[model samples]
Target: MGRAIALGLPLLVVAEIAVFVLVGSWIGYPWAVLAVLAASFAGLMLLRREGMRAWRGFIAAANSGQHPGERVIDGIVGLGAGVLLTVPGFVTALTGLVLLFPPTRSVARRGVQRWTERRVSSAVAGDLFGPRKVRVRRGAPDVDGAIEGEIVEPR
Candidate 1:
């Protein structure tokens, strides 16, 4: 991840700059700048609207005794989209727009979830000292297993 970011960020910046120049040339530089600003404003408005919806959904889910995990994820993704839109790049703005839209957001959500889960598992597995596998058979102790009382010796 670190390596990818180190390399990808510079590449992204360069690409964005190139795109900006190309667009500015095609249109007028002033119009191009205004377009970018307009996109940013639109994105910010969308982010605020979606963010409020996400928060309300979270609260409703919690009140109903349901897990608000999906709502949290939505909020996070929305926030990311908002940030991307504010980055002053057409590429980033496009990506952010996709994330803000429901159809594309669903697809992106799955990818993000998988990536996050993989990263979390790798970190956790690396940190643990115990065996990774657990052997279980039908009729093997209770779910919590048996807890035997042991004497503690003080030094």
Candidate 2:
């Protein structure tokens, strides 16, 4: 994953530059610059709005005795979308816009949840989202009783 990100960042930058140049050529440089500025402004507004909404949702979920993982994940996705839009790139702005919608946001949230579950330990995940079904196996007990042992100090 780290390697992919290392390579992907440069590629993304190149793609963004290419797209910007293409759009500028078609619509004129000034319009393209204005569009980028507009996108950045929109992104800032979205970030503020989503931040408030997420905080409210988190508080409501907690107060209602519901798991807050979903709301927390929603906030994470919203923040990601806002950051993506803030970055000066059309492709990222498009992606951020897609994530702003409810349906797409839900999908993104689910994907993030799955990715996190895979990366995080079950115990930790459970702690965050409450108890989850997990498989357990019993190991055979040691047949030999406790062995005599002494801690020796190293010189």
Cα lDDT tens digits, model 2, 27-146, are 999999999999998999889988988899999988988878778889989998998898998999999999989999988998897777678986766655666654334555457853
lDDT of each: 0.74, 0.84
Task: Provide the TM-score for each candidate, comma-separated.
Answer: 0.72, 0.80
Please give the lDDT score for candidate 1: 0.74
Q: What residue pairs clash in candidate 2, if any at all?
A: none
Q: Write the per-residue lDDT of candidate 1 for residues 1-155, one digit (tens) a residue.
A: 79999999999999999999999999989999998998889878877877898889888877877656566667778888887897788999989978878988877766665455456663443232112333334455556877434322112
Error of 1 at 68 (Å): 0.9
> In model 1, what is the error at residue 49, expressed in angstroms?
2.0
lDDT of 1 at 146: 72
